[model samples]
Every structure is written in structure tokens, then in C-alpha cells.
Target chain A: MATVSLKNLTKRYGNMEIVHGIDLEIADREFIALVGPSGCGKSTTLRMIAGLEDISGGEIDIGGRKVNDLPPRSRNISMVFQSYALYPHMTVRENLGFSLKIAGATKDEMDRRVAEASAILGLDELLERRPSQLSGGQRQRVAMGRAIVRDPDVFLFDEPLSNLDAKLRTQMRTEIKKLHAKVKSTVIYVTHDQVEAMTLADRIVIMRSGYIEQVGTPDEVFSRPATRFVAGFIGSPPMNLHEATVSDGRLVFSAGDSLPLPGQFKSRTSTGDKVVFGIRPDDFYPTGHGLSSGGETEVHRVELPVSITEPLGNETLVFAEFNGTDWVSRMLNPKPLKAGDRIGMSFDLSRAHLFSAETGKSLRN
Target chain B: MKGFKPSAPFLLLLPAIVVLAAVVVLPLILSLYSSFTPFRLTRPETFYVFVGFRNYLSILSNADFWWAFGRTVLLLTIALNLEMLLGLGLAMLVEKATRGQRILRTLMMFPMMFSPILVGFQFKFMFNDNIGLVNNALQSLGITQDAIPWLIEGHLAFIAIAIAEIWSSTSIFAILILAGLLAMPKEPIEAARVDGCTPWQTFRYVTWPFVMPFAYIAMTIRSLDVARAYDIVKIMTDGGPAGRTELLWTLVGRTAYSDARMGLANAMAYFSILLSIAFTVYFYNKLAAARAQIGAEW
Candidate 1:
């Protein structure tokens, strides 16, 4: 039973403070991901929880026991490094059984645990090979197998799939999810890839500049981002965010083009209020090629010139010129479009977002 | 037949081959020939008298020669092992220094930069029985009332020579091992800690294996450099009172120069060269095995 908690957790390196006081609580058997851009303190927070880095101004509780001063081994946690840190001198069997050997487990117990982990990771045939002899994917598997053999209360993964090729990364992502299900241990996975966090995690914690921007399930973070940063960060082809001023009933962009203020922020905003407008590529599409079925209210249409089109197999991303910015819009069902062609683009206002220009916070309640 | 013209590659290599034959091969063949003769430097005309196996057979039966041979092997074995251990310890300490690492590494190699002859003199003075720093310090600290005969007694003089040799060469091992430590990735150590290893266990299982190849490389180099200690032993004890610290090279030097028995000296020199070859081959094999373990991982 491992429920990790960080209260007012802070990290400081001499005169510089990289990670400010942040709080998070993780439940038992829950798979959570802490994801952000580089230098956003995501990996640092994970290492702090792993007992690798010292916390400057807070307490860490792992399995209901305060582990602030405890060493990493006593914290009952295992971490798979970004580079699979397999012992090159040892064979796969020895690598898997090293922790058990150090723990003074009997030969039979060590072999049994090693065999179980190897079987789970499909590393049966490669047991006698050294880490130098294994391929990248196989090495990653051995690293995970080593972690599993220890049976720690918590599993910490620091970008375990980032080194793999795209196809292999996808395959390993599924394998990690399966491993988590079978192991049923509390896993805190850290990565910059939002897709990995979205597909694998039960909850996603998006961080920005040492602060957690939002924490929600995949659907919630995607559909209802809490901040403008999250809205732009969580999607591929990214959400189109434009800065504008609220004048009368319309949000007036700097390029003199205007979009109707999203309906949800009507009560939360007023005239002359500087704000940023946001809409996902899915919400802003070619007029007839949108995903929203019929009966959608507050749909604004404008005839705009298609700047570019990126055809991605089934659907294409249409870049339309709006407010002097090339806004990304999705086109469905293979609409034959070209550059400089005028297209009727639709902005689903009901699904749009408005954020305060000052704080970059969402204006919706 | 066409004119026999040398190829460009062979022409380019001619100078090197000529220099090698003149400088290296000629002397080696001459010495080998001399070892089989009963030639004396004083009796120059006796060089033509080849008394086959006389020098070799006499040295084989001489118990003094055998004792010198065995003592030389024992000294090298003990000195090399102690240097490796101390060098490993020193490297680990220097590697742990967070700041001033470059300065520490340079300071660690100060002993290695000193010439072996100079080191022998320095240690000889320090270990002198009557007026030496070691006995003086011991007497000042009230540890001993007598001036210990550091370079006089047989075992004590041997210890003195080993100390001088280790001091002059241990940095070779330390520098190489330190390079290994610096090039090591920090991830494996962190992984080891998380894998429930104590600090000692992490060092034993991870750090040592990673640096083993470097240590073995240093061992191979120093083993082949056994001649460097010859000057040190010659300066400090010179085979001692009653030949207590007599090594093969010391005996060889005395026979060739003092006794003018060039043929016998050449035979003794050949035997010592064989010892160096055996050590080099052994260490080279250990180095290859160590490299096989972790070389590809890097």
C-alpha cells in the first residue's frame, strides 16, 4: 500500500530555487504522470519523491510514513532511469537478481523472483546475455524487470520510453500499461510526451515553470484545460491561442479581426478586458468537415484563405489565415484543398476557451 | 627481367627498418651471441671463444642467482599489488571531490612526475637509519627510542625499496582509474541506490567493475616498466650489506662492470627479461578479459 504525498515540497540549489513549494497526493495503485516542458521541474519532483534529491522546505510521506530523511533504499521505491542503467558486467539473470542478492534473499528465492520477473517481461531467452549484448528495447525490458524483482511499494520511471523509436515507443507504452496493471503498484511516471501521459496515466499533472498548471484525467485536461498554457501544451498541432481585447460582444484581435467571445466566459468577462482566445484544431475546422454533428449552437463561420495543408493519412490539418496568424484547422474525409484557396472555416464558439492575458488563467468558472 | 624497383610503401618504410635493425636488432643479436660465449670485457680477444651453455649452466646452478631471481619476483608482486590498492583508494577519494577536481587530480599525479632516480635519493634520505624523517618523527612522537635501520636490515631495506618504487609509480594507476571514474555515468549509481544497495555495495558491484579494465591497463604498462625501479634500487641500497637486497639487475650490474664478466651478465639479463615478459603477458590477458566485460557498454 503506497500512497505518496508531497506537502510544500521545494528544491533549492544555493541561491537559485528551481522547484517552488508544490503539493501533490497520489493514491495506492494509481498511475499518475507528471509532465511538462524541459526545465519545468517535473523530473526534479519525481526524483524528490524517489528520495534521490533532498527536499528543502517540506515533508514527503510514502505509505503513510514520513520519509523526508530516509535514503532511497529505505523509501521502498524503484526507478527506471532514462538510460537503462543495467550493470554491463552482469548477465541478464544476474542483473535481475542483484537487488535480491543484496537484500540477502536465499538462492532459491532470488532465482524464483528473477524467473518471475523475466517471464513477465518476456526476457526468458535473453537471461544469460549481458546488457551490452541486448538491443535497446531488450535493455529497457531488463531495466523494468530489475525494478519488478525488488517488489518495491512505488515505481518511478523517468522517461523510460523516450529513447525508443516511435513504433517501439508505442509498443512499450502499451507494455508499461500492462505491467502496471499486473504489478498493481503505485507508479509515478515522468515524461514530456503528453500522448504518453494521456494514454497511460489515470491522471495527468501538467506543470509550467515549477508550478502544476492542471491535474485531471485525459479527457478533462484535453477538453477542459484549466489554463491557457495547458490548452496550448496538451494537444498535437496545438490549440490555436490568440491574444485579443474584449470590446463590446466580440474579442478584437491585434490584427483587427474579431471572434465572438466564447459563451462560457460571458459572465466571467466584460468589455475592454484584455484576454487570450483558444480553440483546438478539432473545434476549428472547415465548415462542413467539422466533427461536431448537427444542432451545435454558437458556430461562427468566416471565409478565409488556406495558407497550407498537412495531409496526415485519413485527415489533413488546414492552416487558415486569421487575424494575421496561421491558425491550424482540421479537415476530415480528404477534402481536396490547396494553398491560397478560400475556404469556409468554422469556429465552434461553444467549445472555445478564454484566458486572462495578465495571469494566463482560464476565464471560465 | 625488368629493373628491380622498390614500391612506394616499401621505400617509405626503409628508413624506419634500417634504424630499427641498427639500433635494436643488432644489439639484441650481439648480446645473445655474447651470452653463449666466455667473453670478458678485459680480455677482448676471448670474444671469439664460444663456450656454449657454460654461462647459462653455471648461473642455473648458482644458488645466489636463484635467490636474486626469486626476490626480484616477490618484490615486484608485492609492490604492484600495494600500488594498485593505494591508487584505487586515492582515485576514489579524488573522484568524490565535488569542487577543485582538476587541481586534486594534478596534485595526485605529483609523485608520478618525479624521476625515479630523484625519488630513490629522496626516499633514501628519508629512510636513513641515523638522520631520517621517519625515525625522527617516531622518536619525537615517543613511538620508538631506537633509530630503525630502514635501508640496512634485509627485510627493512626491501621494504624501503618497495616504498620508493610504489611512491614513484602508483600515480599511473590512480590517474587511469580516475579517468575511468570521471567518464562513468551517474545513472547506474543512482539506479543501484534505488535497487536497495548500500553505498559500499554500490561501489563493489558497479564502480569497481567499470574501472577494472583501466586498472588492468595501468598494471600492464607498469609491469613492462619494471626497469624503472632498477635505478631506484641501485641508488638506495645497491644490493645492501652482505647482498641482502640483491635483485637480478643489481647482480647483473655488479658482474658486468665490477667483475668484468660480460657474458655471464648478459645471460642474467636475458633471464630477467623473461620475467618481465611473463608479467606483461599475464596482465595483458587480464586486461583483455576485463575489457570484454564492459568495453562494448561504453
Candidate 2:
């Protein structure tokens, strides 16, 4: 296991720069996930670390040794591709032992390593079968096993679960997490699925347009996003933002209604300044009870027309329109609320996020 | 039922079937029937006289016919194998070239575009003993004082024909193998590199196996083509000085047209069909096996 660091890494395809000056320090034995949308350079970043791509500018140090000039074979990193690129002609056992055999490992050592990896991956029974004879999940296991037998300093996975079905993806996700915990090897995984990032990563690095948006623990990024982009990207049914202005010591919406500002942020901004207020869906509840139940602080209230109610068995999602913007709220025991029904909702302003209107930066920063 | 009518597909295929019968089926039946008779082109009535495989018996025992048969086999083996090897090497080299690859591929196909008869004439003139450019150049450079009998000697004549054959057909192998290289999945190669395979090791384990079926396919095609080769050899050596390079077609030509023995020639043609069938079946089975190994539905 080793720490992997990228120092001012920049990737350019001719004049267009894809990944512009990214610096990341991944500690030893940490599971870091690079997550982003398509064409966001997350996969490119991982490929650069694996030495599959040339480092246009920057240094990649694996275990404190710069690997920028090394080839992928000499870098001693194993990668599991998105397509589960198992050798079609070789059997599962041969596929698993291929790296070691090429590296001039002894026959006994190769056999032992292949046996151990197969047992760990539950692939002992299918060792004699070729890649064409295996199922999708089995092929994925073989791909992983091929990497496992190499025992490289770092493991790189490029959307390894994307090809599996939903149930299989979830199953393999947990298996990968457990495998990481068991092996305690430094692993760098890349995927576009935020849920996978949330569930699998020790530290999640959110990327957009080839730039790192935010890097933090999943909860840290979820509760305290660095910017409006991070705030909107981290959660399911993302955060809602509405246009508002500070007028006469009160936050006034475009509809001309006044709402109370939190005490900590009240002294930060002056009157006549335009700002946006952000709130998560699960932060709201059916009103009449104040924002605070025990010792928690109370905040503001808004009355709006309920647009739609979605019942998800345990909880309900309530959609409401306020200040000409649609907002979704998570409620407990929501009872058949129909469209055009007036409902008073309460919000805890202490947990609310505020952003500048001009630059989408967080106001608290 | 009163309002039903037939479809247009049958009507569209009726003309093709009629054309096929007239062009292919009729000639095949006529030749098969003539194989059983003592047919002569000059005396047309002799075609009806039943010979009961006497022509086949004579050719089967004739030293000249068996010698020609052996020579044809040897030519096919050497020419086809050499073409495959050279083609495979050229395709691999071209595939690695990042720049001007398109132009290179187009240039590689230039030899295939030339008519075989034209190629034969060109090489025959180049290898001619007294007035050929090759001998003149060698004599000018003081390499040899006398003109060599390039088309008369047994081994040299065979080598000359093989060289012509190779130059003409090597492009077929290269084009087919190039297609295989282009269609191959790049992921496996990347994975192999990450798995610590050296360049040669990667080629041996991954690239070669992926392209074998293509090579075999090219081989089968070229084998059938060379087995029936006539135009080029007919122009260059004309089965030559002592019939040293006599292939099946050259022998059959002498029998049917020059010797005016149509029945014997027909018998020879029928026997040679076995060579084509054997090669076709062999290659077909190999192609099937390759597709099965790769788990592809052909």
C-alpha cells in the first residue's frame, strides 16, 4: 500500500486542456473515488495515474517515487477496465496468472497466487472456463482477480461496475468495499455515479469540466458543500435555491413576502443585497411544530400551494410552489395532499445555505 | 381465399434461377456426362461412345499427369504459405504506423489491382534470359558473364513462378488481416499492458490469436485461387521447356485443345475439382472453429 499524489497535473489534447492543474494527495490505504459526469476528465485523471496516458505536465508519485516517465507495466499498477477485458482465449486461471507469468514468477508461486485469488473471489469452480463461458458478474470477478494476483502497489478501477445490472451493481459495490477493507490496499476508483461515490469512497472528489469541484468526506460534502455547484451535486433530489434580497433587515422574496434570517448570517449582509437561499428537501416538515423540537433553534415559515404528493411507503415527498419557484419537501405521514391545497411549511434557517447571486460561491465562506 | 394473391418475392427470384440453370447447371451436367464418354472435339460423334472411366484410368497411371499433379501441389503450398507470411508481416507493420496509414494501405493494395495476365507478362519479360532487364543489369555489374536459363531450370523456374505468385496475391492476405486488426477491441490490449505483458508477449498471447482466423481465412481463399491458377503461369512458362512446371490446367489445356482429347481433359478437370473441394472444406471447417473459439456468430 502506498500514497498516490498528483502535483499540478494538467492534460491537454492539443490546445484544449481537459484537466487543468489538479493537485491531490491520497494517503496510504485510503479509498478515493473520482466522480464526475461524462467528459469531465475523471477517467482521464485515473488513466494518467495508471500511466495509460502520457502526463502532459505534472508529476505522479506513487509510494513517494515519481512515475511520470514510467510505462504502465513498469509502474506496477493493475487496472480493471470498464469492459472487464478478460483475455478471450485464456481460461479464468490463466487470466488470473497472466501477469505473474509474464513477470517471470515461478510456476509454484503462480499457481499459489492464482489459487488464493480464485478462492477469495469465489472463482475456484470456474477456473477452467474461458471468458466466453462466464456470466457477466463472473467475468467482472475474473477481471478483479486478474488484478488481485498481480499484488501491485495500487489498484485502479475505471467504472468496473457500470456494465453490471442494477442488482449486480449493488451487489458488486458492497463486495468491492468489503474487499478493500479486507485487503487494506490503496485504491483509486473512478465513476460517474454519485451514489457509488457516496457509498464506496473514503474521500469523494467531485469534478466538473475537468476541474475538481470539492473533495471531502461524503457527509462533509453533503452537509457543508464548498460551493453552490458542490451543494447541488452531492445530494439526491438536490438542494433548492430561490432568488431573494435583503430588504429592511428581512429576507424578502420576489413575491414581496418577508422571511426571517438566521441570527449568525443576519449581521453578515447589508440591505438591498441580492442573495440566494438554499434548502434541502429533507430539511422541511409539516408545520405547526416549530423548527426546534427540544433544544434546536427555530427559524421561519412559508405558506404555499401543494402541487404534488408522492408516497414512498415509509416517507412522502411533497412538492410545493412558493415565490414562483417549485420546492420539494420530505414529510412524515403526508396525507393525500392534492394540487392547489394550501399548506404552511416550516424550515430551520440555521441549516439553510446562502450563496451570492453574481458568482455562485457560498456566502458563509 | 377468393381475394388471396401470391407475394412478389417469388416473382423476383424466378429470373435469377433461370439464369443460373442456363449458365451454371447445364454446363455442369454436360461436362459430367462427357466424362463417361470418349469425346473428341474434331469428331463430334465420338462424344456418345461410352469409355467407362478409361480416360480416368489412363491419366491416373500416366507418369506425366501424376508429375504435374505433384508439381501443382508443391506450387500451391509454397506460394500460399509465403503469401500469408509476407502479408501478415506487412499488415502488422502498417497497423503500427500512425501517420500516412491510409495512404500506405491504399498503396499496399496496388499489386492486387493489376490483372494477373498483365503481371505475368511483366515478370516474364523481366526474367527473360537474353534480352531481359535482370540479365542485362547483372551483366553490366559484372555479376555473371552468361545469360542464365531462368525459365528452363526446374527449381529456378519454380522459384520464378512462386515469386510472381507471391507478388500478385500477398495483398489479399494483408488486406484481410488489416481488417481484423482494425476491428479488434483495444481494451484487451490496454489491459494486457497493465497486466505487465511485454510487447512481444502481448503480441503472442493476445494479438496473434485474435488475428489467426483472419490469416486462415486468407489462406483458404488464396489456396483455392492458386490451385486453379492458369493465366499467369500460362503466359510466363507455358508449363515450359519439358513441362517441368506443368500445373493441372496446363496439362488439361494441352489434352483438350492441343491434343484434341476432350474426354481425357474432362476427366482431368473432374479429378482436379477434388483439390478445390478439399481446400474449401478444410478452410470452412477452420473458419467455423475459429468463430466458435471467439464465441462469435458468423
Candidate 3:
């Protein structure tokens, strides 16, 4: 295991810069996920760290040794590409043992390590099969197994699960987490799926437009996003952001709706100040509907007509008219409220977030 | 009459069949019939005289005919291998080129665009004993005082013809191999690099194997084309200088036209088919095997 650090790392193609000057430290045996949408430079950063892409202007240190000048083979790192880049001509066993073979390991040792990796990945029965003979999930397992056979200091995965079906992706996500625990190697995984980042990584690095938007644990990033993009991107059903103005101790919306300002931002907001208010679906529930908000939690109750309801087994998602837009709210317990039925909805102000509309920066400490 | 109309599909194919019979099948049958007779182009009435297997037997006993057959096969084997190597190198270099790739690809095909006759004549002058470019360059460089007889010497003429044939046909290998390289999936190559394989090892294990089937296909095509070395050898050395550079085609063409011994030439031509067919079958089987190795059905 080793610590990988990037100092002032920048990547530019001609005049167009893809990864701006960015610095990051990945601790030993830690799993860090670089998560973002497409073209966000997350993959570029991972490729640079793997030595597949040259660094334009900075240094990468692996195990306290600078590696910017080294080729991928000399870097002692393994990568699993999104295409599951298994050799089509090789059997699963040969694919698993390729790195070992290239490193000049004895045949017996190579067989033993391949066997161990296959056993770990549950690929014993499929060892003799070619990649074209296996299913997508099986090929992905072979790709990962190839990386594991080498036991390199770092494992880099570039959206390795993107090619699998949703069910297989979920299964492989857990397999990767378990694999990280068993291998204990420093890992950098890139993905556009926020749920994967939230579930698998020890820390998540959210990127946008060549800049690191935020870096924190999943819970921290989810509960307290640093930017509006992160706030909109991190949650399922997404956070509802409404533009409003601070007017006489209340948030006044353009659509003739108003709510009392949360107490935490009292010193940060003044009258006529424009803000983007963010609230999660789970934060809004029916008053006296399910679990209490807790005695210490302040809840502001207001009556609103429901517009739509999506029923799951345990909870129902309720969408209602708020500030001339349909704001999604969660309804716990059974509620017989139709689309036009009015019910008292609880607003958990302590959990709300406010950002400056002009800067898109959160106004929280 | 309406219900008895000719079958449309058969009607549509009648013209093709007629043209094929007129242009292809008739000549083939005529040639087969002539091989059994003591026929000459100048003696049309001799076509009716059948001397079954006599021409074939006499030619089989002829040592010069056997030598020409053996030499043709040897030239093909050597030239095909060399061209494959040179073509693979050229394709790899072209694939790595970043700018002006279209122009490079176009220029690589210039040799293929020229007729083999032109190539042969061009090389003939280049290999002339006294006024040749090679001898002049050698003389100017003070390497040798004597004018090298590139076309007059036995081995030198063989090498000169081989060089002309290879240069004209090497592009067949390059274009086919380049198609394979273009269609290759890039993931496995990058994976190999990450797996600690050097560039040479990557090419050896990944790129070369993936392109093997294409090379085999090109080999099969070129083997058939190069088996009959007529126009080029006819133009360059005309199988002269003690007939040191004689190939099967040059020998048969001379016997058919100059000697007017059509029966013997046709017998030799039929026998020569075995050599090219043997090469084609071998390469085709290898091509199938290589494709199967990559798990490609087509």
C-alpha cells in the first residue's frame, strides 16, 4: 500500500485545459472515488495518475517517489477499463495471469496467484472460457481478477461497472467494495453514479468542468453540499432549489409564497438579498404522520394540496404545488390524500440549506 | 400463355449465365480439350488429333520445366514473407502517424496503382549493367570500380525481379493489415500497458495476433496473383541471361506463343495450378484458424 498525491496537477490539450491545477492526497489503503458527469476531467485525472496520460504541468508522487516521468508499466499500478479490456484471444485463466506473466513470475507462482484471484472472484468454473464466451458480468470479474493477480500498490478503475446491467452493476459495486477490503490497496475509482460513490468510497471527490467541486465523506457531501451543482447532483429525486428573496424575516418567492428564514442564516441574509433555498424530499413529511421530528427539532407546519403521489412499499413520495412548481415531499405512513386533498406538511427548517443566487456558493460555515 | 410465363428469377439470371459461358466457361472447356491433343495455334486442324497424356509426360520429364516450377515456388515463398514483414512495419508506422494520415495512406498505395509491367521496366533500367542507378551510385561512392551486372548475372537477375515484384505488391499486405489495425479494439492494448508489458511485448501479444488473420487473407490473395509472373519477367529479363530467372509463367508463355507448342504449354499451365492452389489452401486454413483464435465467425 502507498500514499498517492498530486501537486498542482494540470492537463491541457493544445489550448484547451481539461484538468486545472488541482491537488489531492489519497491515504494508504484508502478508496477514493472521483465522481462527476461526462467530460468533467475525472477520468483524465485517473488516467494521469495511472501514467497512461502525461501530466501537463505538475507532479504525481506514489509511495513518496515522483512518477510523472514513468510509463504505465514502470508505475506498478493496475487499471480496469470501462470496456473490461480482457484479451479476447486468451482464456480467463490467461487473462488473469497476464500481469504475472509479464512480470516474470514463475509459472507455478502465476498459476497459484491466478487460482487465488479466480477463487476470490468466484470464477473457478469459468477459467477455461474465452472472454467472448462469458457474460458481461463475468468479463468484468475477469478484468478485476487480472488486476488482483498482480497485487499492485494501487488499483485504478475507470467506470468499470458502466457496461453492466443495473442489477449486475449493483452486485459488482459490492464485490468491488469487498475486494478493496480484502486487497487493502490504495484505489482511485471514477464513476458518474453518485450512489456508487456514496456507497463505496472512504471519501468522494466531486468534480465539475475541470475543477474539484467538493471533497468529503458521503454523508457530509450529501447533507451539506458546498455548491449548488453538488446539491443538485448528490441526491436521488434531487434537491429542490427555489429562487427567492429575503423580505422582512421571510423568504418571499416570485409566485406569492413565503416561509420564515431558518435561524442559522439570520446574520448572513438581509432584506432584498436573493438566495436559492434547497430542501431534500425526506426533510418534508406530513405533520403527525410517521416518526416525530424529535422534540429538539423545530418543525414549521403548513397546509398544501397534493398534486401527485408515488407509492413504494414503506413510504410514498408526494408532490405538491410550492412557489408555482411541483415540490416533491415524502409521506410516511398511509395517507388517503388525493391530488386535490389538502394536508398539513411539516417543514424541517433546521435541515434546509441556503446559497447565494449570484455566486452559487452555500452560505453556511 | 399468361400462366406459362417464364420464371422471373431465371429470366433475370439468363444474361449473366450467357456472358459467363461465352467469356469464361467456353475457354476453360476448350483449354481442357486442347491439353489432350497435339494442337498448335498455327495448326488449327491438329486440334482433332488426340495424343492423350503424351505432352504431360514429356513435359514432366523435362528438367528445365521442373526447375522453373521449383524456382517460381521459392520466389513466391521468399517474396511473400519479406513483403509481409515490410507491410506490417509500414502499417504500424502509418497507424502511429498523427497528422497527414490520409496523404500517407494514399502515398503508400502508389506502388500498387502502377502496373506490374511498368514496375518491371522501371526496375530494369535501375538494374542495367552500365547505366543503372545502383551501379552509378556505387561507382560514385567509390565502392566498386566495375559496373555490377544486376540484370545479366544469374542470382542478381533473380533478386532484381523479386525486388520489383515485392515492391509492386507489398501494398496489398499493408492495406489489409491496416484495416485490421484500424478495427482493433484499443482497450486490450491499454490494458496490456497497465499490466506491465512493454511496447514490443504489447505488439507481440496483442497487436500481432489480432492482425494475423488479415495478414493471412492478404497472403492468400497475393499468392494467387504472384504465382503467374508473366508481364514483369517478360519485360525485365525476358527469362534471359542463361534463363536463370525463368518462372513457370514465362516458360509456358514462351512455349505457347514463340514455339507454338500449345499442347505442351497448356499441360504445363495445368500442372502449375497445383503450386498456387496448394499455397491458397494453406493460407486460407491459417486465416480461418486465426479468426477462430480471436473468436470471430466471419
Candidate 4:
């Protein structure tokens, strides 16, 4: 197990600084995921830590040892690539045993480790097959087997499941979670999928434009987003964010629609202050169908004309016009509803979020 | 004529068939037929004298012809292998170059641009025994007291011809292998590094196998080129100094032109064709195996 520390880690290609100075402390065996949109430097930061990309000015300490000048191999970390970069010329057994062979391991040790990894990944039958002969999920398994065969101090995954189909991705996600539990190595997974980050990472580091927007537990980032970006980014159907001016204890939108400012942000936000009001689809649901956050549930009900209703078996997603834009509300024990129907929607103000319009920082102290 | 119509495809292919027959089929048939007869270019009457297997039988017992055949094989073997290794090195060097890669690739192909006959003449002058550049450089550098006969001596002549042949065609391997290197994915190399493979180990295990198919293809093309090697040897040695450095092509050329033994030369030329066929088949099989090893379609 290793604690990875990034102190002012920065990466600049030529004169274009891609990953700005970002510091983070990953505890031993902590599965940290760097999640962001494309070109947000999450991958760059991971690459810098892996030593695949050069760090412009920073210190990377893996297992409490400075590794700024170390090559990827010297750092004793294993990486699973997005393409499942198994050696095409080798069989599955050979692919798993390659790193050991390169390390000059004895034949018995190599075979033992290869067998162990294959058994763990359910690749015993596929040992003789080449990567091209295997399916996408099988190839992904072989890649993970290759990494675990080394028994590295840290495991680095660069969108390893991005290449798999949705069903297989979910299957492999569980396998990876189990694998992480079995190995218990420090993992730094980089992915653009927020759900993958939330499910897999012990802590999520949300980045935007080369800067770390927020770093917290999945629940913390979701329930209490530090920035307006995090609130909209971390959720499945993304939080509904609307620009508003706090006036007379009410958030007034540009379209003259108003919401009573949540009591928690009363001390942080004042009248005439422009802010971005945020609420999740789960928090804003049909009346009597809303879920509680277990604290004081100060919910406000409003009737709005439904624009569309998406029935997803158990629960339906109702899209309705609010503040001159579509605000999605989840209907638990969903009732039969259609477009043009006026339904009372509940807004969970206790779970609501507010961020300054000038700076997207949250107004909840 | 109204009822039995000529096939439309055959009619369309008529001109190409006629041209192939005239240029390729006619010459092959004429040569095969002539090899069975005691045909002499100088005496037109001897062309009809049926010799049956006389030419083939004579060549089987001829020590000089066998020696030339052996020498030709040796030259092809040595030249093609050395060219492949050098070309691989050159391609890797160019691939690693960050800037001016386009210019470097163009420059790398300079030797390939020269006609083989021109290259033969150029090397012939460079390897001349008395006042050649090689001996002059060796003597001036005090590496040799006397002039080293680059072309006159048997082994020296073979080496000189091989060098000239390698110089002209190494770029063929380089260009094809460079294309392979360029098309290779960067992820595998990075993965290799992450898997604890040293740079040399990565090259040995990953890069080399990926490019082996391309190298074999180059070998196949150059093997056919070198198996029928005639121009460089003709220009440089011409089976000189009691035919010590004589190759099959030089011997066949002399027999066909100088001795006026067209039938014997045709038989020898047919034997040389067998050598080319053998090398081509071997390289093609190797190419297929390499492609298969990489899980690529043959």
C-alpha cells in the first residue's frame, strides 16, 4: 500500500500549461479517481503521477518517497490502458507473465503468479488464446490480469472500461472493484464518466480546465458540491442549475420566476447578490413522491405544466417548464402523466445549493 | 456466327491476352524449346538440332556453373540479411527523430533513387584496384601498406559487389519498415514501459515483432532482386581473374552472348529462376508467419 502525494504538481507542454499546480494527498490504499470532461487535465495529472508525462514543477511522492524523476517502471506502479494494450504476439498467459519475465523472475515464480492472476480474473481457460482471439471484455480481463500479476504498489487505470460496452462495463466495474478489494493496492483511476468515478473511487477529484474544482467523498461532492460545476457534473441526470439574484430572501430568476432562498445559505448570501441556484432531480420531485434527506425537509410545492414524461419502469422522470427552462423532477411511485398536464412539483430547499454568479463557489458555509 | 456468340469477357480481354502472349508467353516458350535444342546464336542451322536433356546434363556436371550458382546464393544470402539489419537501424533512427522527419526520410531514400546500373558503375570506379577511393583511403590512413585489391580478388570482389548491392536497396527495407513503425500504436510501447520493460526489452519483444512482417515483405522483394543480381557484378567483376568471382548471371550472360551458346544459357537461366522462386517462397512463408504471430490477417 502507498500514499500518493502531489505537491504543486504541474504539467506544461511547450508554453501551454495543461495541468496547473494542483496538490492532493491520497491516503494509503485509497482508491482516488480523477474525473473531468475531455481536455480538463485529469488524464494529464494522472500521467504526470505515473511519470508517463513530465511534471513541470511539482513533487510526486509515492509511498512517501519522492518520484518526480522516476520512470513508470521505477515507480513500481502498473497501469491498465483504455485500449487494453495487451501484447498482441503473446498468449494470455504470456501477457500476464511478461512483466515478471522482464524482471528476471524464476520460471516457477512466473508461472505461479500467472496462474494466480488468471485464476483471480477467471481467465484460466483463456490462457492459451491470443488477445485478438478474445472478446473485448476478455481482453479487458487479460489486461487487468497483466497488472495484478506484477502485484504493484499502486494500480493506475486510464479509462480502462471506456472501450467496453455498457453491460460489460458494469460487469468489469464489479470485477475491478473486487480486484481492488483483493489486491488492496492504491488505485488512481482517471475517467470522464462520473458514475464510474462515484462507484469505484473512495474519493473523487473533480477537475475543470486544468484546475481541481473539488476533491471530496462521492456523497459529499453530490450532497454538498463545493462549486456550481461539481453540482451539475457529479449527478446522473445532472443538477438543475439556474442563474438568480438573491433579493428579499428569494432567488429571482431572469424570467421573473422566484424560489425561496434555502435557510442554510441565509448567512452566506445576502440581498442583491447574484447566485446560481442548484437542485437535483431526486430533490425536486412530484408532490408526495419526494425523497427526504433525513434532516429538516423544508420543501416548497409549485404547480408547473409538464413538458414530457419519461417512464423508466419503477420511477418516471418528469420534465417541466420552470424559470423559463426545463427542470427535471423524478417521480417515485410514478403516476400516469403526459405533456400539458399541470402537476405539483416539490423543491427540497434543505438539500438545495447556491453558488455566486460571479464565482461559481457554493454559498453554503 | 449468329448462333454461337463469342464470350463478352474473353472478347474484352483479347488485346491484353495477345500482348501477354507476344511479350511474355512467346519468349518463355521459345526459351524452353531452345533449351532442349543445341541452339547457337551464330549458327542458325544448329537451332533445329534436338539435344533433349543434353544442356541440363552438362550443367549438372559442370563445376564452373555450380560454383557460380553457389556464389550467387552466397551473395544473395549475405546481402539481403545485412541490408535488412542496416535498414531496421536506419528506420528506427529516423522514427526517433522529432523534427525534419520528412526531410530525413527523403534523404534516406537517396541511394534507392539511383538506377542499379548507375550504382554499379559508381561503385566500380570507387573499388578500382590501383587508384580507387577505398584503397586510397586505406593507404592514406596508414591502415594498409599496399593497395588492397577490392575487385580483383575473389572474396574482395564478392564483398565489394555485396556492398554496392546493399547500398542501393537497403532503403527498400527502411521505407517499408518505417511505414510499419509509423502505423504502430504508441499505447503498446507505453504499456510495455509500465509493465517494467526496459527500452531495449520493449524493442526486442514488442517493436521488432510488430515490424517483422514488413521486414519480411522487403526481404521477399529484395531476394528476387538479388537472386537475379547481374548489373553490379557485370559492371564490376564480369567473372574476371579466371572466373573466381563469377556469379550465375555473369556466367549465363557470357555463355549467351560471348560464347554464343544460347541453349546452354537458357538452361542456366532456368536454374537461376529456381533460386529466385526458392527465396521468394521462403520469405513469403516467413511474412505469413510474422503476420500470424501478431494476430493480423495474412
- The CA lDDT at A140 in model 3 is 95
- Number of the top TM-score candidate: 1
Query: Against the hidden true structure, what lDDT does model 2 obtain?
Result: 0.87
lDDT of 2 by residue, B1-298 (tens): 9987657997798899899999999999888888888898998999889879898898889999898888888999999888888998999999999899999999999999999999999989988998888788999999999998888787788788989999999999999999889888888899998988888888988888888889889988988898888988899999987898899988999999998888889999999989888988998898877766665544
Across residues B43-157, which tens digit of lDDT does each residue of candidate 1 receive?
A: 9987899999999999999998998888888888888899999999999999889999999989988998888889889999999989999899999999999999999899999
Q: Which docking class does model 2 fall in?
A: medium
The parts of candidate 3 lying over 4 Å away from their true place are A289-296, A334-337, B1-19
lDDT, residue A126, candidate 2: 99
The DockQ-derived docking category for candidate 4 is: high
Give per-residue CA lDDT, model 4, range B111-131, as digits (tens).
Answer: 988988899899999998887
- CA shift at B79, candidate 2, in angstroms? 2.5
lDDT of 4 by residue, A88-164 (tens): 99999999999999999999999999999989999999999999999999999999999999998889999999999
Sort order, TM-score high to low: 1, 4, 3, 2
TM-score, every prediction: 0.97, 0.90, 0.95, 0.96
> Lowest summed-lDDT stretch of 10 residues in model 1 chain A?
A259-268
> Per-residue lDDT for A49-163 in model 1, tens only?
8888988888899999999999998999999989998888899999999999999999999999999999999999999998888889999999999999999999999999999
- Model 1, which residues run further than 4 Å from truth? B1-12
lDDT of 2 by residue, A150-256 (tens): 99889999999999999999999998998898778899999988899999999999999989988999998888887788888878778887878987777788887
Candidate 2 chain B has its poorest 10 consecutive residues by lDDT at B289-298
Question: Against the hidden true structure, what lDDT does model 3 obtain?
Answer: 0.91
DockQ of 3: 0.81
If both were scored by lDDT, which would come out higher, candidate 2 or candidate 3?
3
